[model samples]
Target: MKKVLATTMATLLFGLSFPVNTFALPDNDVSANSQVLEKVSLPNGGDSSQSEAGADNKAKEDTIAKKIEGKLEAKDITVWQNDTVNWKDGVKLKEDNAEFKNYLEEASVTDLDNRNTNNSNTDTNDDRAFKGKLKITFKDKSVIEIADQKLYVTSKMTNINNSKAPKNAVDVKLQLGEGVKDSNGTIGQKDNPVEYGSYRIKPGVNILNEEHPQIKNSLFNLVKLQVSDPEKYVDPQWSSGSANKKDFVVSKDNNIFTATASKLFTMTFKFVGYDRDSRKSIEFDKLPQAIKDKLPQEQKIKEGEAFEPNKFEDTIKENSGEIKYEWKFKDWNPTKSVSVSENKNFEGIWTRSKIEENPNPEVKPGPGKEEDKKERPEKENKPKDNSKAEDKKEIPEKENKPKDNSKAEDKKEKPQEENKPKDNSRVEDNKNNKKSNNTFPRIKSNENKSSSNKVYTRTSTKETKKESKTENLSKTPKYTLTINSGEYEVLINGQVIKRQMDVKPLIKNDRLMLPLRSLAEMIGAKVEWDPQTRTAIFTNKGLVAKIQIDGNEIVLSNGKVIKMDSKPLNINGRILLPISNVANVFGLTNGNTKDGIDQNIEWDGDNKTVEINLNK
Candidate 1:
């Protein structure tokens, strides 16, 4: 029966193309021909028709078994889901490749109960859902053992297909099973089969598990990201869901991410005014419409919670008059310029007092201009006569009068009576004396000399006393300052002022910045601050000095500008200036004391004290 079946199969397969000469040959010839045919027979069995038939059946059975086996090629199999798998043409199988059979024998499957609706299960055996342990050898020669994963083999007839997969390439889809763990205990989730092309697989077990586990939740998001080089930038995306916040998480190994955040700060302008009805101060957000209309729209400072200093001027000009506003920080007027910054509140108050009219109205020269001018010359010259009279009073009468024996005698006898009223007898005597020719000349000279002497003596005595008093005052010294470093207490002459400093003296750029008010007062310099210009003016002993905040130049009364190494600073409601520079400008000498033991501006670092002795 097997012989008949083999013959029928052959005829069906080959279409009966065999020659009939073998049957017609003699027995010896047939034996010889049979031996030759035996050499070309299939290897399943021997030359006998029965054995040949059995071999053909066995071969057919093997082919059918391979189709149902569902053995996967161990190549680029991925154990994790959501990973990209590359495909390429695979190596062809050879009969002599014994190593491939050993690899297949080692591969075992774990049955997975779940079925993917998108693709049909290649494994039809209901008893065993496919599961496997495959040893994958990577190009780096490292090996990994993957377990608890289902393996599916796909051919052209199988339902599995990928448009991106290489043509003519046999693919293996690796379906990860729940509770599937690698040798390293990496858990796997149920996912669609990861398809890999034939080129990626080897005949043996291919490890689908990656060496390093997939890191999740390792992405951070920035609300806004900025980079200097946009060409080399890469947009960051979250691992699972959309970024919900302006913050991101980074991996422990990768700790650096560059980004810039958008932020805003507020500046508040608080306008304060005195309410006449309430007799109390009021803070308002809006100015009166009348006041607002008078002000230039661009120059008008809007009363609001947020304001810009640069947009408004220190003083607003109106058609009626100019209104000056003061920025009140601690004082009614701050010495420094207004600086707007984050969350800073600036308080301002408009001047409430009416503008004063000029007390002396200007007189314009008009129809009476010529007569007024003529009177002005006479009025101007009148002071010259008074000045001459004042100068004449300084001379002593004794120096101006001619000394004569009679007068000397008279002065001695009537010293007390001389200044007293000369009675009617002296007048009659002068009249009689003027009547004599030669006697009148001498008598007239004596009378005139006595009259001039009396007037000069009275004025000279009073003027001499006034000059002596002024000389005494000029000999006395003005105020003096004695400073000790690191101590706020300073001695103004003999009086010690304690707690006068807001910020302690600081040394910046090898220069000392001290409180301007205290230093200027001690040196007899008047200090005044100009808010509009942001300048501090110091006047002492006919020398004027102007130090502007953040200005590097100091102007002097002599029209000389001194360039300084550092600008003036405002600290804690006080203007601070370079002490040495100010001292030099004010003509304060820097030298040692009389005893030569201590310097004038001495710095004791050990005690953190600065001792400054003026005029010592």
Candidate 2:
């Protein structure tokens, strides 16, 4: 039966005038008719099918060589960061998978589908594979190649093994996402590359999965790209640590772009100093070395990492050689502790001590004056007389006075001179007293005046001594707070404040709020709570503020009602006020970036600390 079928098939083929080599034979079939047909199809009975196949291949190569060359030519392919591309996509070919297979079938000499299974020793291009080098030139003037995968059907054109395309697309993309690269390879319309941005990569396609192995992770600048505009721009600096450029690669030549997708992102934290009053930047170099050493160092933290700012003294005594004052560190402008998602700067707010003349000026002693002061007791002792017999002391000398007979007779005859109130005698007595005591003349008639002078001298000396004591008492006390287990303890000038409470600091709407009574009293403010109204009245530095629990409006003594970003909270019978809001009324400030108001509330949220600068 098989022989008859073979003969009948040959006869039919012959009748149609079909060439024997034109129709291939089944490898499994072998019969007498087939052998005869084979001989008739070729001269000299040679294996002519191979030659015929070679002829057909030669003809096909001639017809489609230009198309193949075009495919080999570099194409300008724009792909999103971390997106993958195949040979077809790289050549800017519009053909789909089916269309690409058809093209290969028409151009290829051998059966490409069975070539792998049959293991034929055929030329690589003849088996429907891409040939020739794909040179990829990048913006940085670097060059690379797309490794040949031996089959052009679905092989990825990337820089994985030997190819020179970037291991990550971000290394070459002008922007982060989808966009058209102009002829000059610029991504956006901006004149500068730094301002360039791109649209987000199409979701579900570029996502890292089994289907898309080229994309290692999500792109970094997705948010920046989404909010970009022609006028508004996002910085495209790939090296600020937003994206990892270690294994980045990209190349474009002739129009071909070969890039793989990989980029990692992380956020950074830095400490900056700012003037609390002016809200101006303070040069870190200008800060005292002591303060600089105490500040938190800059650090790089990945997203969702735990970050806590270190603590610093609220008031630091600073000396500028010629002057002495203090730099009071305040709370950060924005926040102290944050969950890192973007680049953040935790600026330290500071207030300078008020410049004032020294209350007690030193009276520098002169050389002679110092000696005189030392010898004052000796000189005073020398003037002390032992005898209390006032009259006997001087009367003995006056008893024998002026016994001249002739002078006495003249005085008796001139009764007018004798009756002249004895002025001469008193004058001589006073002159003798002055010589003995080295004293200013006393008015014998005004005894109260002399006594009052002595009292005034003593009073003035006492007052001076009292003022010195008062100055010592007026020194501002330093405070340190320790918060743990939702409770806090205070150390004022190294002495515990003795007031303890179980209240934790609250963060609401990005603003820090705390218990008012402790902070107010520490800063020398008197706090009074009204149970009926749930209000706290604060009196400090001549300003009064009445704040109600769970309310945003603050009624000040000056008759102004100000609304706060966050209201006062009542937690566990303790009233907590928004420190940033009421900082002003209590002679404190927690600087406002929007209003340009600098603050002096020394708060470190990371350590759960609040420092009071009484001097401010």
Best by lDDT: 2
Q: Largest TM-score belongs to which candidate?
A: 1
lDDT of 1 at 452: 33
* Cα TM-score per model: 0.26, 0.24
Instruction: Kindly report which residue stretches of model 2 are placed more than 4 angstroms away from their true locations once superposed.
Output: 1-474, 483-499, 591-599
Q: Write the per-residue lDDT of candidate 1 for residues 23-133, one digit (tens) a residue.
A: 243345344424433232445544556665777687765542233233334332221122222221111123434654554334332222332223323322122323444
Give per-residue lDDT, candidate 1, residue 507: 74
Task: List per-prediction Cα lDDT, in the order shown.
Answer: 0.41, 0.45
Those runs of model 1 whose alpha carbons end farther than 4 Å from true positions after fitting are 1-266, 272-307, 313-342, 349-354, 361-397, 400-616
* Candidate 2 lDDT over residue span 1-616, tens digit each: 5444555566664665444554545656575333433434444555545556677677655543333333332342333333333434343333445643455433312222221212211212134443333443333333334433343322122322222222223222333222223323534332233333221222223221324333332233222333133222222223321243332232221111212111112333344454423335567777777667666656655443334456455777777777665677754423322224445555565555434344322234457645644554334332332232233345535565655544444533453463333443332334346455434433332343323322212113234445344233235543445445444443222223223443776678977676775556556777776656867788876888888876778899899998888877766545677776777665566533244432345666667665554543
Can you give the lDDT of residue 125 in candidate 1? 18
Model 2 clash pairs are 75-255, 75-256, 76-255, 82-261, 137-252, 166-249, 589-599, 589-600, 591-599
Question: How far is 306's C-alpha from truth in model 1 (Å)?
Answer: 11
lDDT of model number 1:
0.41
